[model samples]
Target: MNVRTEIIAGITTFLTMAYILAVNPNIMGDIGMDKGAIFTTTAIISMFSTLIMALYARLPFALAPGMGLNAFFAYTVCTKMGYDWSFALTAVLIEGVAFIILTETNLRDAIVNAIPASIRNAIGPGIGLYIAFIGLKNGGVIASSSATFVTLGTITSGPGLLSIIGLVLTGTLLILNVRGALLLGILGTTLIGLPMGLTTFGGVAGLPPSIAPIAFKFDFTHVFTVDMLIVVLTFLFIDMFDTIGTLVGVSTKAGMLRNGQVPHLKRAFMADAVGTTIGSMMGSSAIATYVESASGVAQGGRSGLTAFTTAVCFAVALIFAPLFLSIPGSATCPVLVIVGLFMLSPIRDIDLDDYSESLPAFICLVLMPLTYSISDGILIGIISYVVLNLLGGKRRKLTPTMYVLVVLFILKYVFIG
Candidate 1:
């Protein structure tokens, strides 16, 4: 591998995903986690985990706290479930351990195949809508309403106006095929927010914040609770599929797949699993392989050196905590909206003519944004898929795992909910 090409590819991948530095802290901070500590933890976890991926998996992929998973940790588990961040962290830890076991036993693929393709495909778009809704709300583009339960916010000025401008600029950059469109969009929007008093200026470089406040703060008291089971399962479900999808997709783009199988796939999964397990101890969300690594692969990254370079970049980013933490919600909101758009691309694969599949997929997609919960969307979608298929005389489409999941989901709604 060419060293310089690998370095450039690594940087390209890091730029595409670096927005997580700003976005994760914002999401977790809302639930009373220390943003400064989270910033440090995020960087540390990303750096080390990606380094592990490079050394062990020998792949040009990066790892970090995932987007939708973080949202679920903060909003669904902590905010709605009335659990604290520690409880969510414990759940993540458990999920990581379970992931490790599944990977070792070679059960990961079986579980992945067990989930219906329609439901699996619906998840990304559902989360996209949910994330976009959050962005709109954060930027003041959408507001809670008394009459209709939701309405448009004032867009002529303030955060809403800034978000609109950022959206246009970022959209333009994306249209032009900019490599770091998301990160550049965040920075550009933050600069625009300076005059509107939405962005605050902090020093660009400094010692990284201490992670002591949030690190190793997991709560195990509720580990046996039903809610904890649901939370852990949800974390595993999302992380498992997302990591697999990223590894396959990026490897395909890089021509690293050998006869439809990803070489070193087990090692890649282990890297993600180990990172997530340790990242919880560092007080971060579930870490996974990033789909954005496709950017680096597209840049001709063919070896672990590219991932190593990206890890080095994350390590360097630790010193810029203040700058990243100072980015206002409005500035990062546009990226979320754009990412939401990116996530929706999978919807094209859903066959709309078959109501047995399409109706459940539609339910899964719509309920995520409307209910503001990813787990609920997945659970209910599975339930609907199973029931509709059973009723429609399409019983062959149902898997044994689907039946078990549908039963558990029904029990959750009937008793716990």
Candidate 2:
């Protein structure tokens, strides 16, 4: 790719994913954490992690606090489980250290290879649906209902209507093969919403908040409890699968996967592990490779230079927090919906003819969006795959690791969860 093209691709990736800077703070803020501190932590960790990916891994993927993982950290771990934020951060730190150890040994590769090809093929599309559901909820196109669990929102509402228009316009631009289509769609939608009285400019620039309130506030008390162990294991499993899934899905599209594996795989894993470990100390959730990076790869970003550009954009974002925060869900949600389309391309790799394979994959796909949890979808898929194969008298087809994972998942739900 030309240097100019790569730089543009980087900018495009940042634009498509920048909504996280605002969204994360709001989500975490619900539980009494300082929103300003979370915002600064989000930007700084994202910048550091992306820079690591660029310089060490030489991949185009961007790293940030993952969507579902953050929800679990805030709502489940802290609010529902009634644990403090420090304990949550400690869980993340432990998970990250375990990932580093796994990366240095054969266990990581073994776990990767142990997943059946059918389930492996399903995860990308599953995540696509999960994220798309997030977009729909975030944009207020869908909402919780007392009777039905979920119901359609008022389409005539300001944000809902704007999101619909944005999705259509963005989809059209992508179909026309427009350069920077995702970025353009985001800005255009925001502009349209300004006149509709649905969005306000929070000024152009401002200094970022200090990270002192949450920085290095980890608590080691009760870190060894059964509940904390369950939390840590959940983090470890989700981060591992999510990172591997993104590597496979994005690299496959970019033609960076050789012989069914990523080139420079060790460094890629290390980048994620190191990022997660550091991000915990910096008061963020588990950092992982973003599936949204596929947007950059789709734009002809072929090397680390693309990631470097994205990292720089994040640094610039710190100064212009208002501009980014000014973008409403109507604008940014379209990018998530569109990026989901890019990720779904790998569904063709699934073996659809075999019932054992196809059934498990189908359940995995449906559960992700329906349950709104990637880890839950993965756990069910693995258990279903093993049980289905065993009942089909295909016992020899199951890997030892697959059996172990099934047992562990069952135990987790039975006792810990």
Candidate 3:
């Protein structure tokens, strides 16, 4: 709660997830958008949106255009669905508008309340595995394989070995209860990479890239088609659950949750909705709450002041893009693995004595990482929960909203997916 500690925690959070600045542009570039514009837009939207989280909601969480959702936008929607970037951005805007409307009403809260407590409890651990998987993949400790889908990367490879070393070092620091363990882990790993030729330093400072190419580029025309509707729904679904999961997971881990629910839920939800709306207008993907904010929480950040400081740090990073971007994936990802552990603390709250509850929760926990989609994991978990309860003659326990969601999820996959 101390200001100095909060500021330091903010810096730690920002550095741990700064890779999004460079990686967002690269991924979107594959879809023919200008990389520099995407980079600038990513940073600007993240700064302003995260500022909203800090000032309005008084939470220590940060916001950014999400990683997996961006891939879906670039590769699946734009590339495979044949929608242009502008069209896809239009869908994002629609999704954001829908989110704002839902959050402002009883709908958002109802949806949150509809989720089984066991499944809600499982979200943290599920996201833990998801974050760890991302760290391993990005750090080159794991690689995709034709034979078995994924396999361990060669330990001798420069990035792979450095990541292993960083993981061990960071895990050790966490075991010793070191303050700023995540931040120190990243910096230490980056230093180790310098000698191994894994990290390259660019100039100390430079002007941020221009946002002109992508600014205000959304296309509303020709968006009334069925495909576009599906795209919008996909954006909406992912944005909804991802934000919900992160808020629940991080807040629970930070001891900010009360009565198994988030306080100020509407404000937090609006922050994410506003971010997505602006990101689409700014020509970026859907923005959501970042689970990496748990790193700040783990570092003793307890209030909005931490987020405000982190926003300031992100703004400062804009001028030193090269210096920040120079951090190798091998360096930052160790924080993900460590933060995953912090998030998984919620698992103790789950009721393992009930098979019906435990089975659905277990499915949710395992599917999140395996499917690589929080929304998908949630979808199946709900469906499974409903089915199990009904078959067990516990149908009276199901909420009306839960039944509605099960049908919606079923229709979503059948028609859109």
Give the candidate order by descending lDDT.
1, 2, 3
Candidate 2 local distance difference test against the native: 0.82
- Shift of residue 316 alpha carbon in model 1, Å: 0.6
Q: Give the TM-score of candidate 3.
A: 0.78
For candidate 3, the clash count comes to 0
Name the regions of candidate 1 deviating beyond 4 angstroms: none
> Residue 86's C-alpha lDDT in candidate 2?
90
Each model's TM-score, in the order given?
Answer: 0.98, 0.85, 0.78
Q: What is the lDDT of every predicted structure here? A: 0.91, 0.82, 0.80
RMSD of 2: 3.2
Span of 10 residues, lowest total lDDT, candidate 2: 337-346
Question: Judged by lDDT relative to the true structure, which candidate is superior, 1 or 3?
Answer: 1
Q: Write the per-residue lDDT of candidate 1 for residues 261-297, one digit (tens) a residue.
A: 9989999999999999999999999998999999999
Say which prediction, candidate 2 or candidate 3, comes out ahead on TM-score.
Answer: 2
For TM-score, the strongest prediction is: 1
- What are the per-residue Cα lDDT tens digits for candidate 3 across 1-417? 599989988988887677677557656876899876777788888998999999999889999998657866876677666788888888888888888998888587655577888887786677677767877887888999999999999767688899899988888877886665666676688788888999887666898878888888878786776667657766776577679878887888788987988877778899999999988888989998988788888889988998998888878878866655566778866766775676687678888998889999999889877876655676788889999999999988799888887897788788877
**Local error of candidate 2 at 252, Å?**
5.2
Q: Summing lDDT over every window of 10 consecutive residues in candidate 1, give the lowest-scoring window.
A: 245-254
Please provide, for model 2 over 188-256, each residue's C-alpha lDDT reduced to its tens digit, 9 standing for 90 to 100. Answer: 888899989988888778998788998898999987686777688668766877788788778987888
